[model samples]
Target: MTQQTENRTPERGTHVYDPATCRVGEFQGKVGPHAMLRPVGGGREWQADPGKIRRATAPERLRAGVKAANERAGRML
Candidate 1:
């Protein structure tokens, strides 16, 4: 872990936005210099700088939840 990663505290299920990739994910945990994030609908996880992470807005969270629900429904088939 690096000093910068320790500076910011992230909560579990913490929603974050990545302007660089125009993507969003839930903060799972911190690893080294990056924060671990899992996709909203259960895809591969990615690492990102904690410094650049920002909390997702209400609309974003709602959209993610709906997407996850739909994905799960599809998997039940």
Candidate 2:
């Protein structure tokens, strides 16, 4: 990996935004040079190049939590 890529990855459990896909996900861990990210509601994870990800803003995290909450509510019904 290049020096730039090495510095781009955030620690696990961090929220990140994938500009290429325009989606937000939690940085679960790393697989090879790619970072594994799972969607807010928790589903199949995707591997993204860390160089393309940025830490999610505070608002993004709030929205993700809301989404997860709604998903959880649905499971109870």
Candidate 3:
């Protein structure tokens, strides 16, 4: 990772993709060296390497939104 990438810290609530876990989550904040992220529509938060995560793409965000919606609909059944 370049120095810019390592120093770049996204603002809170921005959606970021963690390639290590192949998951998209909202940037909560940094915890020590790890960047914390919470799943879309709310769920458990996980630690991700700051250098390994980037802002989520449009389609990835849509997929996550759809999944959250489907999960909510399922619970309503």
Best by lDDT: 3
Candidate 3 whole-model C-alpha lDDT, 0 to 1: 0.89
Pick the TM-score winner: 3
Give the better candidate number (1 or 3) by TM-score: 3
Tell how far residue 13 is off in model 3, in angstroms.
0.8
Which 10 successive residues of model 1 have the least lDDT summed?
A: 1-10
Ranking by TM-score: 3, 2, 1
Per-residue lDDT tens digits for candidate 2, residues 1-77, read: 12224575577788888777777898998888888999987888998878778888888888888989999999999
| Candidates 1 and 2, the one with greater TM-score | 2
Winner on lDDT between 2 and 3 is: 3
Model 2 local distance difference test score:
0.81
Q: Candidate 1 residues 18-67, lDDT tens each?
A: 65566778989889978888989778999887887778888878888898
- Against the true structure, candidate 1 reaches a TM-score of 0.77
* Higher-scoring candidate on lDDT, 1 or 2: 2
Please identify which of the two predictions, 2 or 3, would achieve the higher TM-score against the true structure.
Answer: 3
For candidate 1, list the clashing residue pairs, or say none.
none
lDDT of 1 at 31: 91
Q: Count the backbone clashes (under 3 Å) in each candidate.
A: 0, 0, 0
Error of 2 at 40 (Å): 2.7
lDDT string, candidate 3, 3-68, tens digits: 217678999998888989999899999989999999998999999999789899899999989999
